[model samples]
Target: MNTLSIVIPALNEASNLPAVMGTVPVAELAAAGWRTEVVVVDNASTDDTAAVAHALGARVVHQPERGYGNAYLAGFDVATGDVIATGDADCTYPFDALPDLLRTLVDQDVEFMTTDRLHRTNRRAMKASHFVANHALSALSRTLFRNGLRDSQSGMWIFRRYIWDGLDVRSAGMAFSQEIKNAATTAGYRFMEVPIEYRTRGGEVKLNALPDGMANLRQLFNHRFRRQGGRGEAGIPAQKQRSERYEAV
Candidate 1:
């Protein structure tokens, strides 16, 4: 079976960990020919978050930095799966949808997948902030990267290892989402977006759209000039992560 590394970027997600863990239908994912491993990226959390995750058989990693993408990059450095899965730890995205998400990645033959939370099935269930930010980011992505994005900032994404070729990414915050989307357009890599429901965070929300929105807009222009002008080198294949040993899920 091809391994799947499910990375959840969390900050003080202690109370919600058990709930999120329960959302993953283990049998469904296992039956899909995936050996699942969950990696929790802790962003300097000040709680028993690590202990709780370890107790539930999840591998926990801490990043010295404090930001969504920073935690993601830290987890990326440790993943060993051929395909990497990233979703927020705030219990907004349903982990039970893993089967569907993974299926789209393979059936579509794409290296990148982003989920649209406002898609008919989930829009009725989403918070206003989520609906607005997704719309804003998606529009901005289309303008800058020309990727025809419907949910550019969605934390729910699955990426094949090989798509890293011809891409150089350096954003350390929420900007990582736009950076990847922009690179995909420039590199001409295949990407697909499917719809999923969005629920409110089980705890305090870690995001502020206005400021993050500005950052995202800034990234779009930066990427446009950098790609259209003679700036970045062609993408290179992503290297295999050093941690080959299985960490408990």
Candidate 2:
């Protein structure tokens, strides 16, 4: 049976880890013909994040460098699954929806599947300013990259592990999410976005909205022009793929 590595990058999220980890439907995924391995990347948290993850039966990989992308890169290196899935350690993303998303990924023959939290995001889950910023960034990304991504900053993504080898994503911070999606689409891989419920987080929010948003804007422009020479080498197979919303059952 193929394995699915659920890699979660956590930074001082000890209070939120349990709720997040508990919702991963390991048995359901197993029943769906995929064995699940939860890999938690401890991003140099001062709290008991590593211990909490371990106690919850997660394999903890310690990443001394503290960045969102650094933690994910570290977790990806240690993940032992053919298929890799990502979600935040904070309880905002729905881990319980993975089995359904995985089924959609395979059935649709998608190489990279990212979730859209912006479509159905509640006011309680995201601030109005942050929501506006997300929309502006996503719009710019679509215009620059010519890909139909609704949420450029969504952290939840599921994709074939081999695709990572071909991607040229280099962002070490919050901009990594947008960069990875852009890389995958630019590489002519099949990509899709599914809608998922965005919940209010359990711990203190870590995003420095203004600075991170500005950095993401810069990264999008930089990445777009950097790959200009090799833009259509493979052609965009993802564009030919559909971008329908996934209605959860």
Residue-level lDDT tens digits of model 2 in 1-249: 879999999999999998998899998889989999999988889999989999999998888878888787778777779999999998988999998999999999999999898875465688889988998999999999899998899999999988886776677899999999999998899999989999888888989998998899999989988744332235422221212221101
**Model 2 superposed RMSD (Cα):** 7.8
The RMSD of every model to the true structure, in order and in angstroms, is 3.8, 7.8
Tell how far residue 133 is off in model 2, in angstroms. Answer: 0.7
RMSD (CA, Å), candidate 1 to true, equals 3.8
Error of 2 at 14 (Å): 0.6
List the pairs of residues colliding in candidate 1.
165-236, 166-235, 166-236, 167-235
lDDT of 1 by residue, 1-249 (tens): 988888888889999999998887778888889988889987888987777887887888877678876777678777778888888878888788888888878888888887777676676656677687778777867876677878777778888866654456667789887777667656777888887878767888777768987887787777677634322334332222334432323
Q: What range of 10 consecutive residues in model 1 has the weakest lDDT sum? A: 237-246
Task: List per-prediction Cα lDDT, in the order shown.
Answer: 0.76, 0.86
Off by over 4 Å in 1: 124-126, 227-249
**Top-lDDT candidate index:** 2
Displacement of the residue 200 alpha carbon in candidate 1, Å: 2.5
